[model samples]
Target: MSTDDPWRPRLAARARLKFDPVAKQELILFPEAALALNETGAAIVRLCEGARSIDQIVDLLSKNYANADRDALMREVMDFLDTIRVRGLLQ
Candidate 1:
């Protein structure tokens, strides 16, 4: 897939999302590094399972967070996804 494609996002092969029982937090685990995710980050990552498009994720989240502005939420989601992709944690 093109790196620029935002229609569907997927966790990179080396990365996986898991809940750390000890920390009681969501984490993205890769080879030598792990990222702790906030609630919103976790929610977004969970939807990046290679099935849902960026728009779909934003739509679902907008419903779940009814107070959020759709346009702002989209920008935030895109930024988060871009950050993860740059770190080689997302595809």
Candidate 2:
């Protein structure tokens, strides 16, 4: 996590994730809402389902998108995560 990047725990931390292998997609359903995720988002959601921190997510993304600059890559990943969170895609 960067100094400028805010980290907020999921509002409903007890929420769980479900993956639909047949659809090659993932869904994060909270008590109030749910979100359907694509492959990349699903990967991130998978990483986040464990106890790994944001830095770990950034590292994973960096290794996956090797051509990207470290800081910029992390920023983009953080931005995507934030967007999903706001859209109720993350628990």
- Which candidate leads in lDDT? 1
> Candidate 1: lDDT over CA atoms?
0.91
Model 1 agreement with the true structure over 57-89: per-residue lDDT tens digits: 989999999999998999899999989999999
lDDT of each: 0.91, 0.67
Local accuracy of candidate 2 as per-residue lDDT tens digits, 45-81:
7776545567777788778878879888667667777
TM-score versus the correct structure, for each prediction? 0.91, 0.63
- Which ranges in model 1 have alpha carbons more than 4 Å from their true place? 1-6
TM accuracy, model 2: 0.63
